[model samples]
Target chain A: MTVKAGLKNMVLKGVNLSIGYKLHGGKVLHLQKELNMELRAGELVCLVGPNGSGKSTLIRTLAGLQKPLSGSVILDGYDISAMKVPEKSQLLGIILTERNTVDNITVFEIVSMGRYNYTNWLGTIREQDRKKISKAIYLVGLHGFENRFFGSLSDGEKQRTFIAKTLASEASILLLDEPIAQLDIPNRVEIMTFLKKLTHISDYSVLVSTHELDIALKIADKIWLIIPGDKMLIGTPDEVIKSGYLDELFGNELISFK
Target chain B: MSKKYHTTLISLLIVAVICLFFLDIILGSVTIPMRHIINILFSRTDNKGWEYIIMQLRLPRALVALFAGAGLSVAGLMMQTLFRNPLAGPYVLGISSGAGLGVAIYTMLSGIIGTGAGFIISKLNYLGQVTSAIFGAVVILIIVISIVPKVKDSVSLLIVGIMFGSLATAVISVLQFFSTPQLVQKFALWTMGSLGDVNWDQHMILSIIVITGFAVAIFLIKPMNALLLGESNAVTTGIEIKKTRYLIIISSSLIAGGLTAFTGPVAFIGIAIPHIVRMLFNSSNHKITIPMSAICGAALLLICDIISQVPGRSIVLPINVLTALFGAPVVIWIIIGKKNLRTSF
Candidate 1:
């Protein structure tokens, strides 16, 4: 895809980016190199790749959790590396793959923590913050589970709670790592449908990483396929499928597209 | 729990603390009547004998138990939250053992150096023991803080802390092995722990240190709540994990070090009261737990002190022995009753 001229509404952009690690002996371990990407408002993009294909590394680099080996990730045209944590958190909400270990906290309390950046030193929830928390929980269909302990929730419910937490943050761009990895088929479909609905209802730009290729093909506006040899193919699902890159990316033995 | 329930629980705990305070002051071996106790507390009575017993003996002991109990419990709660471990406590990072080693060194060498060693043991008396214990605790704290930055995982740091504690205990045991019988007996008595040794001046200092530590702890409640989600989540929440960790370490050190320096490592209260509070409140919100744990801790220790005094009996049991006997059973019951032990607050 060509780089567009208007960049005002762009939530995220990566220019000449190489995402990977720097070794102790001063060696740079580059996973993927010379990447250019842009995520716009109200777009749901899916990032898919094989195992050990640096999908998590790319997400981490984009979320400003780690520094790029070269170039930069620009969020709202500001360099993500230059921004403070609170400033970055205000613009980007991240959902990690790790299961939350916090126990004995109610769902409402977990959702309210998304206001960490906006709240005062004591983290007192204002009336407006409560409204936002309730709305987020309602959006994820967890309105009645407010007082339930997070530890007692099912895996699907836990995933929804995390999404509610991210929604409560009110960040324009949401980055999720395997958001539906642990969900059943019904929950997976529901979550995908909800993500798709969120883009239409609100100006949220979501970039999600997942292995469910069929769901991504149906729901994502743009698909980011990490092909072998440190390259990425970015286009609409139809464009990529017609280009025959998905077949080349995953061999016939491992996967066959319907 | 609802706000109303929280308020009610806190109120009941406060009332219990008040009742336990009176029980601790009134029910000692001498059989001082409740009226005389009240009179001695309120009026400037000319009865010198009763005044001396109530004011000098019972008052300081009760105050010591209250402060030491509150301090140790707060320290334990902070440690458990900071490390995200169920077994973590005030002594997990070698603070108590460091204090024990300090007392052992003092008692063993005070005999060897004779009474003429003015700076070491001759002049300060109880003050000297407190100073040395604090010094030793601070030393171990510095070592732990220095190592914390190098270790990436909290579990690894917890293991290192346990190793440091074991090292301190081994050194103390060696000191005990070679010391004179009289010196060994004094150190053994200190190990058994006593709240009656503190005077009014020491009480003033202990209260000041404990209050400061608790203030720091209260200020850290928000960050600690964030930390319950684990370190990466906390970082994503815009909390500076390094700064919060250092504050927790310093606050815990202050409270545990002060209490151990004074009360000679009073056991069970530090490790048990937070669990009790969590169970009773049915939540792990640090804002609620921290203050409630302090009140419950004070009450629990006051009850234990009353039990140690044995009501009308002249023989006072060691505080450590009674704490373990009382506390271990409750902990076992909590473990048995909990259906999901892994998620225990």
Candidate 2:
């Protein structure tokens, strides 16, 4: 559990990781293998490859939602693979593809829940929590719509609600799986642009699993080009983009932004 | 104030509740006058028998209807929103069946165990029934929690809950098969679901529990709203979804389990009223929805209670039968409406 020297920069660590899950037929198939990756601070990292390349599995494993077959996901040098539920929540903020519906609640109150860790066991909101919610709304560019109904929101607006909620968590690091999966084209552009802004100014690292390679290329600070045949090529976006890794990785299956 | 709009609706519901209360007091198997009941309340001299009949029989029955309505309605609202499935309610989770199974056990065992001819004539027997119902509800809740770590979809989990419900019902039917004819009559009567069995003391206890259940549900609005999106989404917002889920199931059980214990399993309001509230309020805020559901539930149940009493001459119908009459169609509408709208929950 001790923090190592080079590991100080690591927000998340997956050492010798094997990520996969049981299918509907109840068979465990390996999506990837023996991978040790360090996700650093304040970097927007994208995972891109062909269909069913285990992009989501990797995010789920690192987010502590699933158990890895081999190796460990060490968050902030702490072995989070076996951490308690509440303890795990404090270190990570996650946005998955799941859609939510609790009827008749405002976007503000929903986003404010990101402060659950900051509140007491009784779970009442504090003034500081209010401040965080306002900040998150601002970050998501949802300033005037605080009182809007979540059920009434457009898909883009709802996505922003979830993002504001994630922001309210005060998490130093985020793991997003297909953040734009439910968004329209324009909203997709806005969320990615905002995510890019988050990396530079928010001092928070984000690891996103996405099929939108073109969007990721335009925004990501770094790219973790997951080509699925060998070691993951990790470097600056310019380096990864210029190397034609995205084209070779997709192999003309129509997943690339180009 | 939008707060004022909520308050206005509550006051309107209370007014409806009061009208229903006095209406129940006046119109009964023997029709009494509004003037006479008022005189009886302040009659100075102890009109003990008449007062006892009015206070004991009529008032408690009506209040029981009110609280029972609130409890089931709130639990349904919580469950429906949490699961994001329109069909999800306390009944879907097997909580109602769990409570019914408890009643079935007591009703059947008291026969084989043959405690007495008038076993239910005593208050202790009622207490036993309540405790057993709570025990059954707790057992189902535990099973629900164990499955939480396994399943991801709220709708699929609801399906699991309903499957457990069917299992509980199947077991109860077997108990009904073995129990004596009279005991079976008692069990069947419980299933018909009336508010009449609540005497003064039982009425107070049920009221306290229902009110407390509501308080706890409103208290968890932050996490409950967080929970709407999904478990992990809630957690990412610092909501411990596991604990929040536990809180919701337990609190929902406390309400649904308690009402089912005393009043039998009343249907419809739990399933229908939250939707009505959501529709009327036009917002997705629990701050509004919680209170809105409470009022909408109370008013709706008051109307149902009045309708149940409408046989008029002497006999009264069971409230549950009347509720199911209204409830089933609303559910059908929601199902059909869901078909048309491409939306979540």
Model 2 C-alpha lDDT per residue in residues B230-299, reported as the tens digit of each score: 6656665656666667677778878888788888888888988887776655554566677777777777
Q: Tens digits of per-residue lDDT for model 2 on A92-112?
A: 778888775553567887787
The runs of at least 3 residues in candidate 2 whose Cα sits more than 4 Å from the true structure, single-residue gaps closed, are A1-10, A22-28, A82-91, A102-105, A119-128, A151-154, A181-187, A241-247, A252-258, B1-4, B33-36, B39-44, B102-156, B172-186, B204-212, B329-345
CA shift of A229, model 2, Å: 5.0
Candidate 2 collision pairs: A100-B229, A104-B283, A104-B284, A104-B285, A105-B284, A105-B285, A106-B285, A114-B237
Residue B66 error, candidate 2, Å? 2.1
True contacts kept of each: 0.60, 0.57
Residues B106-216, model 1: lDDT tens digits: 777777885477575656657767888888898898998998888876777789889989998899889888988878888888888889988888888888988899999
Query: What are the TM-scores, per candidate, against the unseen true structure?
Result: 0.94, 0.84
Point out where model 1 deviates above 4 Å.
A1-10, A22-29, B1-4, B115-123
Here the TM-score of candidate 2's chain B is 0.87
Show the colliding residue pairs in model 1: none
